[model samples]
Target: MKETELRYVLALLRVQGIGDIFAKKLIQHCGGAEAVFTADAAILHRIDGIGEIAIQRLKAPAVLEKADAELEYIRKHNIKVLYYQDDDYPERLKHCIDGPVLLFTAGKISFPEQKIISIVGTRQVTPYGTEFCKKLIADLAPLNPVIVSGFAYGVDIVAHQAAMEHQLQTIGVLAHGLNQTYPPAHRKYCPKMEENGGFVTEFWSSSNPDKENFVKRNRIVAGMSEATIVIESAGKGGSLITAGMANDYNRDVFAVPGRVTDKYSQGCNNLIKTQKANVLTDAADLVYMLNWDLAAEKCKPVQKQLFVALEEEEEKVYQYLNSKGKEVIDRIALECNLPIYKVASLLLKMELKGVIRPLPGKLFEAV
Candidate 1:
């Protein structure tokens, strides 16, 4: 949390071709980035991956200026910076192979001892996929677990929204800087998240939301979370990257099953069939697998109520609401493949019973 430490760390990270792994090695060998900067070239080269080019880059005035700019930006925004050695640095992420040497954060950060789950999927999620995400988040909320996601469209947006609705802390690992939210459409929700959870990034404020950054961001999300839940993904999607990273991090990976024909579900189904991920039918399976006692206690009683009163259709709707969080009537109908009028009437009845609450814009939250 020291400003000096943050400045030095950002300087080291700015060195060309010196990524998290190399940066960590440099830090460990030299004691810190400050030491690395002042260390002899011969000693710097002795560290793994610290070749002459990287060493030369570290010594460049331009590189120093960039690092100083990053530090200034952090100061301007009052961003909380955590070096890997800091106690507040996420232990789970630290254990990962390529964890960041420095993290830039905004808003409150909660490092829960409970299970952490990363929900990920395609940005263009299907209606069914969105519904599933909402329900899953609602079910997991009472356990007070930390939810992690990329804050992209589709499943990611739904997961964050659901967590917010339930007053649960959620972290969005950005591919860009904390200076701006990607896709601009997410600006409104970003402030909401700042008030409750937080935003985290490895990139400096001036860094662009480049393609490679997202791939790198996936590792942080997977590394920090105890498990990764892929709500709906295509064969080639960023969610797969997070799932792969989770596997690499030796964390449990779960995927919701969808109809075989569902393009969004194909990646999830493929992951299960390939034994890359466990097939999750509902929140219970996830909770059991994680050995989440807190979530189990809250879920068991609700399971009974869910089973006793819910008809097949109502159960499906409820489950959708629970997973996807609050959703519009049109979306629910499209997801459930039911008539809009029928879905609306059912939602009204559920709303009256305190099972869900209707929000503005026809959005409904599971109560």
Candidate 2:
């Protein structure tokens, strides 16, 4: 965004009684952020939600002064600002009405046709949860999905570490400003994270990690991903809140089921019992549900492996594709007399074996 426009956006957010939704409404109704300030009072009053108080707040000179100071802080720190209307913003997050109007980022973070998933859980992570998180990320590494978390204790750090271990990009969504790290101990991980995936926040330099800020931050964790996975949680925790937010956003939510006797398993069990989340046994469940396996094939070169072994069902699909060439998955399933779910699993296996390749519009061919 241009410096002038950014200043207006910052000022717009600083105005009392205005938030992301209203700021966006104002920006759109008046053409742009600058226009919102310049719009005539008569025209502003004509808009639905614009009341007298809000219009009066828009005229505050201190708002622009604060914006200028914040803009300076942004520039001095080399922060990257992602405007909601810009293409560079997270596409999934763009759909969220309450998503930040301005997202401040650090490090080299890019969202290029990538599969992004957020993994969140309790701060008191059990050994079982840690192992599950590690194994999940390791298994899903081949598909190369971006791992997102709140950058808190336990499950959050574990997920971020696992992603880094697999050489996958991991993002840390913070409740506080970019100027400082919460929990302070996790400060060591910042440099490494920024090198690859980095940190993102809607908070300003003055903002602190207050209690309510985390609840607000949870929405971003849930909003930016294709799905949100809960490794473990107590009866009522932030991870459950994130799951709730994900459900509200109509995004897939998965919970790793544990023994009912376990203290941390209560939340996951409740979510499953209420049908708010799908039971996640392993990485395959997520891969299958999100159709990520089919999408993963596109990331690789279509080179046929010599003398590759295939399962009985896999051979059927392979034979059909070999003869028919590129075909939709549904057609391949019909021709091979295999179920669609089975076909999807086989296709992913075959792709891993370098026997078949995916095409645009969900078509596939024998490599």
Candidate 3:
């Protein structure tokens, strides 16, 4: 967070072809950013990826001014800047090939070093996609993993909103700068995120939300998490891109399979078929794949019996109802693959047990 180090990091980013990898090397060679600024061209040229043109640009007055301006902008906005060497830098992302030399963060929430999962999918989500995300998030909530995702609509929005509702710390990697929020309609939810979670981006304050930035943003999402989950997507979308990057980074990639005929499910199904991602049918599938042990040693004796009493079918119905938000008896019967009379009787019993409540029009939801 030193001013001199911040300025040099910004300057390094401006140099052509000198990205996070080379920047770290330069920092190591020169001892620090302050020293990097003072080092001669001959010294800079010896480092890999540093060409004559870039070294000259680094020494130029105009380039220095631009770096200074970036610092001034950060100062004016009260933004938090994280350098690669800083302890606060996300450890999962620090080793990424294209990780940013500096990150501009706009909120107070600290990134957790524990299990982190990125949920991504098509911007145009279907009803099934929505329910899948809500259910997955609800089940994962108890594990306390930090949820990461883009702030785009569809799966990203649902993931973030559900995480917030569950009181889980979530991080949104933005396609643009923190100066503005893309899809301005999301402005309302952002403050809630800043209040409860955080927002992050590698772009400078004035950087526009260009088409290409989204591709760049995907790397941050994939690299910063222990795993990536594709809720729904077509063959092409940012979610797929993130999944590919996650694989490249040797991180676990899980995809939710939908009906084979559904366009949104095709991408996920294909990923699983090709062995590019693990098939995720529910939260337990993800938990098992990630090898997450949900067991706690301090639990009350009665709590274990309470959980054991519920049959698998009851748990499925409970989770489905919680995820669906609301559904008619007929719809639940269809979705759960249960007979109408059987579903109706179970619904009444569950209601009496305070597991769910019924509303008008035969709608029911978990209490």
Candidate 4:
């Protein structure tokens, strides 16, 4: 795109109350960002949502100055400005109505025939969540999928590190601009991250990591990916919001089921229960859902449930475990109306029988 056109697009962005959606609409109706300013009354009248106030704001001198400053920063820092209409822009996001008109990115990024998935969850990720994230990335490494995450902490940083370890391209979609990292502690990873796939945001250098910006950022993470896998979440958080946006976008969504009693697992459990997400145990579930070539990528086959006979008491415990996804022996005993000792003995037998496996934190799940 022309330098002049980008300046106009950036100016459109600086207009108060003119977000990505309205900005894109204005640009579309006017033929280009530059054309929007010079558009006559007839041109503006034909645009559905344009009003007199919007036209006046479009002519504001301060907006152009701010855009020029941002454009200068882009040129000075060698930042790649991805226009929504351009080939370098994310294809998945282009289909989204509220996708950014211009995305400022800094990275060795390319999306040529790639599989992209966004892994998101609470910043206070548990050990179980960390293990599941690392394992998921490791298993998906064979397919060379691009890992996308918020880069905040916990599951995000873990996913990025695991992807880097596997030498797969990973992008940290930022809530702030590329001028600075939000968590400052994550600054060290920036250089290494840009080497593979780096940071991206719609905000200019003038923007900071405000609270609302994070929510807005979630849409990009959810929009660009073929699917969004929530590793873990509480009853409320940004990850669940991302899953909602992905659902709104009609993209496949998956959630790793956690024990019903676990605090961090509540959001995922609810998503699964409400049928917002498919049950995701492994990368195989994703590959199967996305219809990625099974032969081309070597993902471990999903294990089919074993048809095993059980005593009445054992069957009750087994059903409880299966229903909860994962459960501790105590929870099982209490829920199934069995004594703790009896449940422990049954679990031992179940483990020996290769029907269930024990997890860290005394959790057990049907195999």
For model 3, the superposed segments whose C-alpha errors exceed 4 Å read: 296-309, 312-367
Task: Evaluate model 4: give its TM-score.
Answer: 0.80
Candidate 1 per-residue lDDT over residues 224-304, each given as its tens digit = 989999989888888998899899889999999899988888999999999999988667567546655432333222322
The ten-residue window of minimal lDDT in model 4 covers 294-303
User: Candidate 2 has what TM-score?
Assistant: 0.86
Instruction: lDDT winner between 1 and 2, please give it.
Output: 2
Clashes of each: 10, 0, 0, 0
Error of 3 at 191 (Å): 0.9
Model 2, position 80: C-alpha lDDT score: 95
Measured on C-alpha atoms, candidate 1 has an lDDT of: 0.80
Tell me the TM-score of each prediction against the true structure. 0.80, 0.86, 0.82, 0.80
What TM-score, to 2 decimals, does candidate 3 have?
Answer: 0.82
TM match of model 1 to true structure: 0.80
Question: What is the C-alpha lDDT profile of model 3 across 1-367, one tens digit per residue?
Answer: 7897788788877776677787788888999877887998888878877788777877777767788898899989989988877898899888887788888987766865577899999999999999989988876676677889999988999999999998888999999988898889899998889876789999987699999999999999999899999999998888999999999999999999989899999899989999999988777567546655443232111122233345666777888999988898778888899876567546644543457765655567777
lDDT of each: 0.80, 0.91, 0.82, 0.86
Q: After superposition, how far is residue 354 of candidate 4 from its true place, in Å?
A: 24
Give the C-alpha lDDT of model 4.
0.86
Better of 2 and 3 by TM-score: 2
- Cα misplacement distance, residue 103 of candidate 3 (Å): 0.9
**Please, what are the lDDT tens digits per residue for candidate 4 over residues 1-367?**
9999999998888999899998888887789999987888777877888788887888889999998899899999999989999998999999999998988888898866578999999999999999999988877776678999999988999999999998889988888888888799988998889998998898888789999999999999999999999999999999999999999999999999999999899999999999999988776567546756432333333333467778788788878888889887678889999876677657654554557766666678987
